[model samples]
Target: MPRGKQTDTKLTLVSQFFYPDTSANANVLSELAVGLEERGFDVSVVTGQPAYAPNDRRDDQPRREMYKGVAVRRIFSTRFDKNESTVKRMANDVVFFLSAFLHLLFKRDEMGVLLLPTAPPFLPILGWMLSRVRGYEYVPVVLDLYPDMAVELDYLSEDGVVYRVWDQLNKRAYQAASLTVTIGETMEETLTEKYGPCETAVVHNWEDGSVIQPKEKANNEFSRKHDLVDPTTILYSGNHGMHHDLESVVEAAATLEDSREEDLQFQFIGEGGRKVTLVRMTKDRDLDSVSFLPYQPVEQLPESLTSGDIALVSMQEGVEGLCVSSKFYTAIASGQAILAIANEETEIARIVEEVNCGIRVDPKRPGQIVSAIEHWLDNPDEMRAMGERARSVFEERYEKEEAIDRYATVLRRVTT
Candidate 1:
């Protein structure tokens, strides 16, 4: 609470999601909080109640709980139905945004530095307002570029009034922040161009190496349990959301169905907006080689990931700089050869090319995806070598420790 001694005060992280939640946001934030605490910084997290899974949703979680040595305070917010309308989802975001704002507003004195991410997408504006009012530094960690993403996803039109208003708010929020932290170089470039040059840092999302390491497919328990013993599995794991070009993966599966005689399977293991559509398409096409599974628990991640010979990570063409899929890092860590379907200029493409860990193909072309798969199928040795290179890159550049250290240093510098 004293001037010039910010480290003594707790650093507060504001997020709509946090520990014990299964989403990538929660998991990554948990790692960062624990790492900061280990670096001798007092940390507290202000987050919404855990309800990542369907059955886990509750009216409220305990007001406070300690998770991985980080003190967490959960705010009571409205829970929207899973089948709810977009209006309801926005309402949920609004309710949580306000709840988090008022909670942080009252407790501002106890906190030294405020760190927030774009989960609800507009919540960082609240943090910016509080920083202006209470004189504490607010750092906006941009996981996704909003208004742009909303427009790209067809949720909003670029020329619409809603989009204009949201874009203005976004600019103001970024301009007010003491520093802006985003995930990738493409995102950094986009933010700077749109928001007009703020102090930005690009710290990539990383994999928890200890939890997700390379394992032989034959030795993987998940594969054995699911009877996925065949080595010709091409896995697409993670959020099968609208931003991902998963439909093309299905198209590729259909394209190769008759040509390939091997027992090849295209496995998708996660839930998202696109998952249902992908499932229906796979069923409608009668693609027996394609399979779907619910998201596995965090403990089963390594086995589930390693079960695949090659991992398919994709992003839609126009949504390149908005957000990079975190699954790419996990795939890298799992030592599975990656076939990235993304824009060539994006960060994922750059990383895959730089590390020599994967192949990047045009997201729009299913034929290219099919060709890449067939090539890997024929040259197993080359694929294995690519996977090894991916693991090496994961260790050298995208490990949890490196990302945490970068975050910790940024937090410390801002506080000082």
Candidate 2:
């Protein structure tokens, strides 16, 4: 832990998002950088200006700053609107890619290891290209599988030339990495099948128990503000993006409109492309039991998360292995029972079963979803037990300290 020895163990984390940004990726990378810095490793982050806020930017912010003993260098990139057109988004990605490439190229000697996540989806390729000559250990963290996600979402055809080219690049990136890190075993399995065997680690994303813990709704600000006091709240809080199957939840609400108890409610907090559709469906079906709320600030996350009786975690049909919901960990830490609307065989479902934290209902089955919620409502004791078990398992396995240490260990192993 000497200063001189620490200088030789420098780590450079490259991502499009970082602290002061509200994105989940930003939070994850920020925590990792700070944790690594505390462990006596010289850590620096190469990121872009604050741009994740929809249609906003801090144009006057400085390009460089020191945050909590970690060196943060923000690159100059196009400050396009966060919800811009596809061409504009790609341009933004290109600008960051070029700017980050230059920074890493010049500072390659000092960076003993590079941790790059697939934010822009071009970063792994950039690192793979540089590692050929730079000789720095490249560790690619697979947050979401590219090209496959696009194809699954119908943005690109699997048989198209673009898909084929991107798939090949993705393969090369995984192949070049000294160690590939993904959040769940399902994602790791998908990567293995797609690119053949590679050195990979399945480190689940974690939550800070102190930051997001159980709180009584009567004392919770979010619950009181939103009048979420009486109902047994079924909360879906996070990005309602294309990767999630929120329609099933809406259908479940409509199905139980008359049969559900008067005190039962479904709350959707957050915004994305699918949110509009969800809102329309609720109104068109005259589902009075449903309520929509904008995403709460991070400071309010604890109260908002704990306001729910059961937290809903969902994934679209084909998106099982492509991405894991980070909200799942936070929901567990919130001490709420989990109702996962995904494949029963998925990693999230497996965790729910192993911990006895909640139930799994396939998103394609609205009846099953309704039944699961109703069953939980009928058995309050079982629900309370599940919530208790959720917090216990979270502290034992998904706490921030342990997960970050595991990540540090993986980086150390690959570099040494």
> Candidate 1: worst 10 consecutive residues by lDDT?
1-10
Kindly list the per-residue Cα lDDT of model 2 for residues 1-416, writing each as its tens digit. Answer: 32333545678899998887777778888998998888767888888887776523644456789989889888888777644456777788889998888878867777778889988876888888788767667888888888798888787899999999888987888987999999889999999999997899988888889898998888988898888888888999987888888998999889888886558789998777788889999999998889998877778788987999999999888887888888889889998989998887778888999879999988778888899988888898999889989999999999998998888788777655
Listed in order, each prediction's TM-score against the native is 0.95, 0.95
Q: Which ranges of candidate 1 are over 4 A from the true structure? A: 1-9, 58-60
Alpha-carbon local distance difference test for all models = 0.84, 0.84
Query: Model 2, residue 16: displacement in angstroms?
Result: 0.7
lDDT of 1: 0.84
RMSD of each predicted structure? 2.6, 2.0
Write model 1 residue lDDT over 185-232, tens digit each, in one string: 899999999999788888999998988888886788899888787748
